[model samples]
Target: MRVISFINMKGGVGKTTLSTNVAHCLAVHEKKKVLLIDIDPQFNATQCFFSGDDYVKYMEDGSDTVLDLFDGDVTRVSTVRGASHKSKKCYEEIKPYKIMDNLYILPGNLNLFKIEISAGSGKENRLKKYLDVVQQLLGFDYVIIDTPPTPSIWMTSALVASNYYVIPVKPDPLSYTGVSLLQTIIDQKKEDLDLQLKFLGIILTMVEESTLVYKRCVETIKSTDNLKDYLFGNFIHKRTEIPKQQLSQSFILDLEKSELSYNLVAIIKEMIKRIERYEEHK
Candidate 1:
């Protein structure tokens, strides 16, 4: 299975949108089993798949979430050391919520942010270990992890468990500045952890084609030596329909035929091809 994380050092860059839509496209169009893990403490991805009432109920019921795995790991270690016999089993099989026939989501919770602080040493690898168990017990063709905008323990865990990372950038100067920050983290992690993660590509999102600033921003990004090759050929344009569909909790594929949906489909197809090519070379 291939694991990919959608991340950025800046917020409001549409990382969640890309992650959710890409997973939806792969599952609905390619007929692949896709698991989307929401690592963002804001629970944006989780909200995407459920309504306000449903989400409240899901949270109130204490559904299995990313926090479960992290907290479970700590308990498992304490139990092994004979610290607590009442420690809960860490490797319980977590059944993801089936959003579609082949699409599932391991929802995220706000408590994850707090859990990170109380986590034990070597907790950065907790996500990777949990995914190892998940892959063994319940297989999937692809795993898409959506990370928070800031650099945090949650983001680190996602990066450690990812095979590739995709950065979504807005057509603006501040967002462009975040690219360097992200690259530095990736470079350091690759050496320190000996991770085999690859850069899937930087996708320009929320673009307004008619604006001069948009054109200038695109030019600057494409001309930058470090970012040129990593920039995606196609960009996702800013569309009113996107927010409408999102507020209604509708999948990109299920939306009516439109420019945004068409571009999303194209981007996903390109992503699949890129992954395939990477696998071939590997």
Candidate 2:
């Protein structure tokens, strides 16, 4: 399976936006069996996929979430002893919520915020192991992981589980400034975990088309060799319509086409092309 994480250490750059739309388009338009995993403690991806009322009910009903892969009855013995986790009968099979014919969602939980991450907890690979088993049993074509914005354990877990990482950045300098730091962290994680992660480029979000400052920021990003290497050509324009679409908990692609939807479709198309190229070279 092609597992990708929509991630950025900086928040408010539209990771959830890219993650949800790309997953939805892949399933609805591209006819791929897609699994959208919400690993963020905020569960914003979960919020986007389902309505507010349904999400509240689901939380109250105590349904299993991505947290189940790490906590619940799962054990850390595999991490301690260097053994295979599949041999242990620690976890039960988790049923993801069906979004449509070819799409499913493994929801996130607010409770994840409460779970303490210690150095010796050894629960980091829980997500990777879960994805491995699901790939064989469920046969997913793509797994889109929406990660939290931080240097926390959840971020590490997402990196560990992903085959590639797609960063979403805003036009602001603060967001651009963090790109180098984020790259350093990713590089370090690749070396530390011995992971074969490929870069899928950066998606610019909340951009002002006519703003000179925004234009200059884009140029500066393109000038940076590290940033330019993986920067996507298409970008999302700042749209008030997106908030309206999101309030109803609707996937942007499912609704009528707007500027937001148009930009996102272009980005998703580029993403597929880039992934195919990377796989061919590999």
Candidate 3:
């Protein structure tokens, strides 16, 4: 399975919008089995997917959220002996909310903010190990994670578990500032865990095609040697209806003929091509 994280250090850069739609397209259009995990403590993606009151009831009903994965009493096991082991944390059946035929979601929770983690607790690998077991048993084709817009354990866990990570940047100057800091963090993760995580590419989002600022941002990214090679060729334009649609638990792709829907479809195609290219080169 291809595990990917949609990340950026700056908020309001369309990170959740891009990730939810991409996963929707992959599952609904491309007919791939997808698992969307919301690891953000803020639970922005969870709010987008479900109504606030409904999710409160979901938690009240004793349904598991992403918090259980992190704070649950699942002891760590040293090895995986052919998918059957004493690692109850990794093997226990996790019931993520099923959104559609091919899409399942592990919702984020507000309670995630209360958990305290310490160093050398092997907490970072909890997600990675659990994902390996679940993917093997469920036969998923893609695992897309929506992470918080900060450098935290959740972000680190997502990076540790991902094969590739796509950074989303808005057409703003401040958006570029955190790009380097994120890279520095990823580099540190690589050195510490020897992770093989790859940069899928940078996606330009919340774009204003008619604005000079938007055009200049594109030009600047293309001109910069480091950012140019990693920038996606297609961009997701800023749409007024996106927030409204998400508020109603509707995906852009659900609009069928909307231009915003096709915009996501095109980007999904590019994402697949980029992943294929990496596989060929690696």
| Candidate that would win on lDDT | 3
1 against 3, candidate with superior lDDT: 3
- 35-135 per-residue lDDT for model 1 (tens digits): 99998999899888989888767755546777776664342122224443223347556667888798999998776766645323787887898788888
Query: Candidate 2 at 240: error in angstroms?
Result: 0.9
Error of 2 at 110 (Å): 0.5
lDDT of 2 by residue, 166-239 (tens): 98988888888888899899899889889899989988888897998688778888898888777888988887
What's model 3's overall lDDT?
0.84
Task: Decide which is better by TM-score, 2 or 3.
Answer: 3
Candidate number of the best TM-score: 3
By TM-score, the better pick of 1 and 3 is 3
lDDT value, candidate 1, whole model: 0.82
Candidate 2, which ten residues in sequence have the lowest lDDT sum? 79-88
Note the residue pairs that clash in candidate 2: 201-230
Q: What is the lDDT ranking, best to worst?
A: 3, 2, 1
Q: What tens-digit string does per-residue lDDT give for candidate 3 at 1-282?
A: 999999998899999999988888899999999999999998988887789788867765657677778776543222322222122233466677888899989899776787887655788788888788887778899999999988888888998899999999998888865687778888897788789998988898888899988877878778877678898888788888888988998888888898888878889999999999999997
Cα-based lDDT at residue 70, candidate 2: 69
